[model samples]
Target: MIAIDNVLISDEVVEEQFVCDLTKCKGGCCEDGDAGAPLLKQELDHLNNYYEVIKPYMTPQGIRENEKQGRYVYDRHFGWVTPTIEGQICTYAFRDAQNVIKCGIEQAYLDGKLPWKKPISCHMFPIKMSQSEVDPSMEYLNYEPREDLCSAACKLGKKLKVPAYVFLKDAIIRHYGEEFYATLDATAQHLKEQKG
Candidate 1:
């Protein structure tokens, strides 16, 4: 049996007890828009450098999109990311020789080259950062954990055992900042209360 903990969800937010069915979901977040996620200056530089190194391997359309954007910007809900190819599901995702869906930069990062990291928006999904109009504070809201609706390709064979909130808080702080995280936490708590 596959060990549930081996599934790679967000390190800071996903807990061991959580299980998702990614097959049915179609990576909704990735297909939702063209703007992608926002990026910090340092992150943008890292991504550009990664792009340069991987230029030879990227599709022509990918190169064109990168050249057009020039820099990454936070597109509200999502952060900075490469623009998607026409009719393609994800800009950074592609199938390898064995036909496995893979992320080019993620593979590079795993290989020890520091590719630009994924934006928080793409990194954290289902769980969202929502802000109250009456208050500047934001909240972290998790869409109910539904394994049945996840994409088959992305699903693990076993259950996960980690707490979602812990992973989320760590990620928020890492990508945004402590202040932003605090606000998000407050927002999440408020939303939870409202739901209850």
Candidate 2:
């Protein structure tokens, strides 16, 4: 494990390889999970604030689901999560020309309609962070290797020699800041040397 700033990072982040193969997975992560996309407090606020623009890009069913669930929903099992269409695909997701699920929130951000990118949690694929049991102010950054959706990604990343922390640099930086990510990079290099 690596400790930087207030985050405790798992070594698997440096050891594991992963790169999302969207073509094969077809954004399965957006649809396969039992629950909707998890949301932070600020994300819930942003969803409400940006609903006017975001609504146009969303599917009719997605819009209706959002209306029925009220932007976001709180569940005992999942805590606060983005509303889903009958608890299937995330309400913020839409199909592209290839019929692959895509995030409407991210599309809006890419189009310069919204200032923030999609949720940090969404951006940081395969990495889940939780408050540290030792210290609540700090966080535990762990690698969670999901099957089906991420297996191809893992193989692809291994073929290309990209580690999880390196593959997810931008998202890690976004969530934890540049200094934290720099430490992760350093940790990766050290691990590589140790293996050699």
TM-score of each: 0.53, 0.95
lDDT (Cα, tens digit) per residue for candidate 1, span 114-187: 64445555555545444445554533334334344443312442334334554455565666678766654565
| Per-residue C-alpha lDDT of model 2 across residues 54-99, encoded as one tens digit per residue | 8887999999888888888997765788888876899999999998
**lDDT score for candidate 1 against the true structure:** 0.49
- Candidate 1 segments whose C-alpha is farther than 4 A from its true place: 1-17, 20-29, 32-35, 38-42, 54-57, 69-81, 130-141, 144-196
lDDT of 2 at 72: 88
Model 1 Cα shift for residue 109 (angstroms): 1.2
- Which structure among the candidates has the greatest lDDT? 2
Weakest 10 consecutive residues of candidate 2 by summed lDDT: 127-136
